[model samples]
Target: MSQLISIPESYESLNLTHINIAHHPPQSPTATPIVILRLNRPDKNNAFTPQMGESLEQAYRLFHLDARVKVIVLTGAGRMFCAGSDLDIGFDDRVERAGDFRDTGGRVALAMHRCSKPTIAALQGSAVGVGMTMTLPAAIRICHEKSKYGFVFTRRGLTIESCASFFLPRLIGMSKAMALITTGGVYPGLSKYFGELFTEVLAEGTAVLPRALEIAREMAENVSPLASYMSRALMWQGPTSPEGAHLLESKVFHHMAGQSDYKEGVNSFLEKRKANFLCDPYEMSPGDYPWWSEVDIRVGPKASKSKL
Candidate 1:
């Protein structure tokens, strides 16, 4: 049994101070701690507010800086994962403040994408609009066999938000993605056809949270944090061509193949014991961590067409 970690009573953004932060024991003695980030709005079906968006970004930062948090399992407190944005509170600060362009949902999605730690969304109940789009960037999304979900943008006369265009198609394929966005209907899950969208499904909503903890414990116990973070970054941020991917992989290999963690892993394998990987992920990462610096695009001189 691992001792529970206590968070300070000071995270004030996005109502994060009220979030249920709990630690679950590792499946094995070697596993690190698993943190649960539960949405605390059972009354509103855990709807997203601008405050919630602020909290999400801050929460991720907290997770990244904390060495004890190996993995994050995101779930809701009520029967539903999230009921999308809170419609009852009818104000337009999120849009008006952003010059009438930025969607708060997209901000939350960007926050999730920016997080270095592995994220798993445990969808116990219905999630629509921002609720559904927000989970698209998670490393893994788990739900019950018959869990409810929705795209709900077109139906609400609002276009898709939360940058789902970049993530949804990549996840469920373009054809299904288009249909879901356009149709905008709530649907039940656990279909054998859409296996990629779901990492694993439980028998019921009640089991989703427990199953997420189990999966998180598996990752915390057996996986090296540095390797996992780097791998995830490469998968999302690496170049388009196979050669580009190879180059990035080679760079990461060069950076990680000779580190202390690598040596410990080798020695542990030879000794037939659980490896104690002590290397911090941030330290193990190459310069600037993600290492994908943007370069200015150069245009070629235009060739004037001569009459032929």
Candidate 2:
């Protein structure tokens, strides 16, 4: 007999918009237990603002902390899963305050990468720039045949962020990463050639989101929660040496302990209230200084200056 675990009633009443982050959920449960997180801003082609980024980070944190959630299905709303950063919105003033925008994306990516639960991204349309990077930390990806993936950093006169510099090459090989990063070209048939990058490639117009939900439900229903959790932890920890993993764990532990969100998370669960996290620990601190010094191109020897 399948062991039945009842989802908390509070889960139903809690703001799905906040938790879902995209205001969409599966129509019904599936074979695997699943949590669906949708990116709601379809009007902007699901462009990620700083708030959206923080919301995503928080949503993942919530899923990780919840004993009930076994797997996560990440997708976006409207025609595109995500169109990348919102250039139309202008630079966020907080970007200056945060010092390095890369850190914001890096922290979120680290959280996703280190999560003890598996994550799957369902891609239907365009996933560009950070949208592309966001999918990197996912354990699996399912994309519709026609969906397009691109790395648009160079086009924007910027370099890759979100630890893509480290993670992308590891996944797709250095040459491929360089080609994509340098040229800013969209890669079709990515899911086919790079199955590791995408676990499955669906038929064109196959409804990617529905498939993701189905998978999530199946995982939830069939898998043993404890075993799945342990397996996830093992997989996350297996890559590093015990000493290195312990150090990393300690850093996250200490950081979380110092944050208000840590307290809010516990108190909210105990008091049965929605957690309103006061601080975003994922934001980059201003103290990080760049290691590379700027080059003085003009200091190079001028063509005729040495003639005398």
RMSD of each: 9.2, 13.5
Candidate 1 residue 190 Cα shift, in angstroms, is 2.3
Q: Which stretches of candidate 2 lie over 4 Å from their true place?
A: 1-32, 90-102, 190-195, 225-308
Instruction: Report the lDDT tens digits of candidate 1 across residue range 1-308.
Output: 95544444333222463256555653332213577788778988888777777777667766775666678898998888888888886424543233444566777787777766788999988788888898998999998777778889899887888889999998988888887888887787765334478888777889888888888878877677888888888887888999999988998888888788888888888999887777678566887666787433233355568976
Deviation (Å) of 216 in candidate 2: 1.8
Each prediction's Cα lDDT score? 0.76, 0.64
What is the number of residue pairs that collide in model 1? 1
Candidate 1 RMSD computed on C-alpha atoms after optimal superposition onto the true structure: 9.2
Q: Which stretches of candidate 1 lie over 4 Å from their true place?
A: 1-18, 26-32, 90-101, 191-195, 294-308
Tell me the tens digit of each residue's lDDT in model 2 across 130-157.
8888888887788877778888889989
Which pairs clash (backbone N, Cα, C closer than 3 Å) in model 1? Answer: 14-51
